[model samples]
Target: MKSKNYDYYLIILTSLILLAIGLVCIYGIIYYNFLAVKPEWSSLYAEYIEIMNSYLYPFLVLLLISLGLCIPKRLLGQDILIKSSALILGATLVLTVIFNLEAGLGFILAVMIGIQSMVLIMTFRKSRAVRFEKHGYVVRLGSSLLHLGLVVLIFNFVTLRESPSHILIFWTGTLLITAGTIFALYPDRITRLWYTEQ
Candidate 1:
């Protein structure tokens, strides 16, 4: 029988792309609003923000589409719960775009959190070895932390539009990225030593 599993490399590549896009979006928003404070750069800042806003949602939608393609259909399963969750998440994202309502965005964020949590739970339950294996753990940990950073970012978006929130988002994202890099590059011996009890 043909394997039902998707290529792990493909999943990891796509996820890394998604993470980069998300970080770029966050950085653009932060830079335009806070760092581009010079009087002369006002027009440039406005132009940049305008261009980014115009393309951001469409890019996100495309990312979701690509992610769906990358994920194995069998893994998702044909179930009422999965269908309902997908429908609700899609509707919430559409509402967020149309109304730009905080509640709608919050709902979308909540749905994302729920979905990521479920994914992580299932992954851990099925693949304890993957979670601990040096290379395998990098993929698992990087993806999980990336999802968590994205969720926190969505919260940062919905909450007060202040420096504190921006700082929080930046630091949280940076931390996730930094940790993922370390996990990916460090020697297996170090990872094993760190994770294993003496």
Candidate 2:
């Protein structure tokens, strides 16, 4: 029992630490890749930066909510968190589908929100009692969905602007999406060969 409790603590602590690192990296991406290249708000880069900035709150909320669940909790709170996460993701995914089909002002928003939804959905699913759950499951699945969505979105965005450079982004995004999906779907098999007797 003590060992199991210790394992739980380790998992939560590790997750928290990684979450912090991811937040920093996200901010760095915004700061260095987006904000640093701009006349502030005049270009697509600016729009991307602004959109990423919007994710700060959601990311923080997710981290906090995950922390809440990492501790002992009443069933009500767990249910609330689980359902709310799912709802948020589901709503965003629906919006993404709408945006993808409609051709409108919210293309970027749709893509980003879609990615967010994918992440939240996978996170919620992993937090459940699935024997298949593991460290990379949620992130890999979410990233795969996000990558695939971005491939299409970026292709459209770049094509609309008549740019050739973005083709690299498209290919890389597809590769990442494919790799992530492979990992998410077959993590146990992939890692099994790496295992040695404990």
Candidate 3:
């Protein structure tokens, strides 16, 4: 990667880490409507602090790194970083699952993350042989949207039961997934507006 790109990535990584920390600090403050009795928010917050201090932080670190690894080659650049990151991601996931390590949302995210990485890697390799893919940007954008929708769907498992229905997000994600699939699989059939190049 170029120096400018590295700088941007560094900025992004710093921002994501800061955002995650902020989220973790505010985690227990989230209100759920269905509790039979108002429990001690302070104790709950303390318990989570302890959990994070004990071992959860490492898992979060790994997760953030995995997220970074999954950045598409088109966004990050066509570098060996993608391949290396994929290998590291797969190894971390397999070892974590096999060893029975525990972290909140770790198991669910692991499966989806692994699958996403594999799919992206395979597609990156296979794209060169694909035919009827006239507009490269459309396919790449669609692939990114498809993955984003899949991730959104996966997060449904993490929400509280009493929280507002995720159906709206679900349908929106379905739309993105459908549109993305069409853009990726039938690029040639896409309208002429996407063809800006001669």
Candidate 4:
């Protein structure tokens, strides 16, 4: 008798998923900064840089992927209400791309980022809240907020790079990370404010 390799299946599936998302995140961070500033590489390929800096291609791909995810396989089996809505959304995305509708594209991009940000925050809250509580209340709350702040600060660096508030964001993230680390390492112990002789 032979057994199914479920462990391998899970490992491979998780690894691929993580790599896919991580690669895109890395690319966006690096390329967006590239678009923000013209170094030797951008200067060398000025034509290509100009095209990419416009952001149409990346926006099209991202919008397509985001809207495409709406038409789930389960929805395909459902009644017209759900399926029609999905179809409408799909068609809207297609038309937006075909027509190069600036407003629609911008709105969709905002929606995509807003939805993902909400999900990301919820994920951090749900997963970290419990784990941190195990250590202690002060550690849990302090560390979780600090970690979230650190992430938000980093996100600002990426998206709000136009202002170049580098010093503030960098220090904020560094402080958050440091405080979170301290909270994580702080020992869990009982404390007494005043001792009375029994």
RMSD to the hidden true structure, all candidates: 6.5, 17.2, 14.6, 10.7
lDDT of 4 by residue, 66-101 (tens): 332321211222254345545545655675677654
Weakest ten-residue segment in model 2 by summed lDDT? 67-76
lDDT tens string, model 3, 73-133? 3333436656756665666567556764333344545555555555555555655522222
lDDT of 2 by residue, 24-78 (tens): 6767676666555666645566666556545543444343234323322211244
Rank the models by lDDT, top first: 1, 3, 2, 4
What TM-score do all the candidates reach, one by one? 0.55, 0.31, 0.38, 0.35
Choose the strongest candidate by TM-score: 1
Expressed as tens digits, the lDDT of each residue in 77-167 for candidate 1 is: 4354346557765786778778764555556556555656555565546554222222465456555555555565655654445755688
List candidate 4 stretches off by more than 4 Å: 1-135, 185-198
Cα-based lDDT for every prediction: 0.56, 0.48, 0.54, 0.46
State which candidate, 2 or 3, has the greater lDDT: 3
Q: Which stretches of candidate 2 lie over 4 Å from their true place?
A: 1-114, 117-161, 193-198
Say which candidate scores most in lDDT.
1
